[model samples]
Target: MFDLDRWIEIFQTLSKNKLRTVLSGFTIAFAILLFTLLFGIGNGLKHTFEEQFKGDAQNSIYIRSGRTTKPYKGLQSGRRIQFRNEDSKFMNDKFSEKIQFFSPNIERFNVQAIYKGEQNSYTVRGVYPDYQALEEAVMEQGRFLSVLDIKNKAKVVAIGRLVEKDLYGQLSALGKNITLGGISYKVIGVFSDPGGDNDERFIYTPFTTAQGIYKPNDEVDRYGLTFNPSLSVDQALSFSNLLTKLLKEKHNVDPRDQRAIRVQNYAEGTKNVEQFMGVLNIIILFIGIGTLVAGIIGISNIMVYIVKERTKELGIRKALGATPKSIIGMIMMESIFVTALAGYAGLLLGVFTLNALGDSLEKYFILNPSVETYVVVGATIILIIAGTVAGYIPAKRAARIKPIVALNDE
Candidate 1:
């Protein structure tokens, strides 16, 4: 079955048409290359989003206030609304069983912090002890706010990793004084965040202390609540609905007003991420298939042309007692050889490009590049099928041509 003469003859014919063969092969290679890169970037986007989600409990819910949308029980629209600390207290008292962590957050505007002469402008957050758990903060040095610190309205502060790096220089931050809004506060802890782009350029202090010192207006921006992780997604949903209703009544807004207050549901957010990822993958798959189909069509057209050019040679072989099966075998072998070489070459090129860019991608890109074993296997099978189908029709046409007609034309 492995005829050296037959192989030599096929190679010789292809070599004679070098430019045409290269063009055909290039089509398949580009198809695979584009497919690989698109899918890699899509996966990278999904990975970035998933990393953002990992910064907090997936079952958590966020409640923030915005201006009222509709006239609420005769109150005019365009009124600025505020969520108070008492609202957070009310939730803890009412939903003690459902809620895991409750933190009322208040923001200080454009606070200037100074450490030894280095100055930085950062937002100051007033939070309870549980805020650390909600933010997924890892303490780098010293400790986070203890219960006593929040209870007694101590002036203890926690600095983010970036903040520490900018201010502390070579010295440790613990037990040092950092001035916020011209008031000196002792640094109690230094912290780091897993997600690099997020707002870790701040200082956190006790909510009560912040209310008394900076924001005496007592109007807080938002309240954050995380449910017990052991709770089901449905259970989280139920809690969110209940909290939304309770907050609406407390804020004196119409319960039906969709924009009166915003409650960001983690379950819905997770679902949206999955749906987006699915759409991206479907798009990638279709583009890849389309490219490959074009290449296959090109292969089919070239094979037909090759058959036309070799008519006289096929006729001579047929007259000399070569079977139709042998003729088909010769065509199929050439098709397979071209398909495998081009496809494998394209695959290697894609992998090499990805490897070269992987580190730079990880630093500046939000997406992950992935190539599974099954994907490779699937591509290989698709290439084989494409080659076989392209060869089949032309070989059949050659077998049908009578030896007398083919020889007379030559």
Candidate 2:
């Protein structure tokens, strides 16, 4: 497939009118560069979203109590709804077969933690064992709370990396005693998270331990639940609705009081995220194509000017028995060489720049870089088509020029 002679001819022709060819090539190259950057950013966003979803069950549903906006079952509007441990137990026992994992969250604020007289203020959580999976925490030392810890209201605690650094400094925190809210708990685990500041500012203990130590009178804040993996989206929605109605009835509240209890469905979140990304991709694609169109127009104009300058040469060739096909092929070769070389250069430059920026760029904007294969392929095809079209009109006009008329013209 390599045609060294033909390529030499293309280079020779390009060298004759260096400025014009360079300008055309620059247009195509700039277009490719702009397109590559847009697509790279789009892909990055997709990657970041995927990573974020990994931290929690994408199909999980969360239930939280809120104030009623409308009167329900003799209760007045503005009444605050509360969910207790009994509600969580009821959901687990009633829907055991439908559920995969479930937990109740009890969180308190501004807990003072002290280790060897050094102190810091952080949020403390009383969480079930499943909180490890729910929050996607990775323990760096010892272990998370076990079932026995919860049952016995053990004094063992798991602290975040931020807490460990503040309390222990460079010293190992495992097996050490730290006083939280004036009650001492043995440090059983130190953990890390992707949740940034929020994760760093929280400590975890067994739910029972936390409740007994902190807010023994307050109800649990929310219920976190994930259904069996085999469940369909529609089925999950229906099942969640049924569970919501049962909970409303049990609490002596009206079923239709949306504000009294809120159910957050990951399936719905997923649908919304998909639709949003779809619209975003369409806009990005249009911008890329629009730039390419401008580049194509530039290429077309340059080819027309080059053809005009070569009118006499083309006429001499025609009189010497050169066919119209040969003339068209020569013009096309020049166009293809210029566009392909510039476009490829632009693509490489864009890719290199993005790769260098990597996670740093992503972290700043809370997005990820994730360019896909199909986009690169699509851009290449567009380059070729634009090149061919740009050359065609000028090539046809040159082929029609009469030898006598072309020679007579200045």
The models' CA-based lDDT, in order, is 0.80, 0.82
Candidate with top lDDT is 2
Off by over 4 Å in 1: 1-10, 37-60, 66-86, 93-101, 133-143, 146-155, 182-184, 194-198, 208-221, 227-241, 256-260, 266-284, 314-330, 345-377, 392-410
TM match of model 2 to true structure: 0.80
User: Which ten-residue region of model 1 has the weakest summed lDDT?
Assistant: 365-374
List clashing residue pairs in candidate 2.
43-370, 44-368, 44-369, 44-370
lDDT tens readout by residue for model 2, 1-410:
77788778778878888898888888888887888888888877776666666657777888998887877667788888888878877898999999887878888789999999799888988888888876778898999989999899999999998899988999989999999889999999999876665686689999888777665775788878788878877788888899889987887677778878888878777766787789988988898888778877777787788888888888888899888898888888887777788888888887887888787886555365646657765785687688888788888888988888877767
- Model 1 Cα RMSD, 1 decimal: 5.2
lDDT of 1 at 166: 85
| Clashes found in each candidate (C-alpha, N, C closer than 3 A) | 3, 4
Best by the TM-score measure: 2
lDDT of 1 at 137: 86
lDDT (Cα, tens digit) per residue for candidate 1, span 194-252: 65635578789988888888667776778887887777777778878888898888877
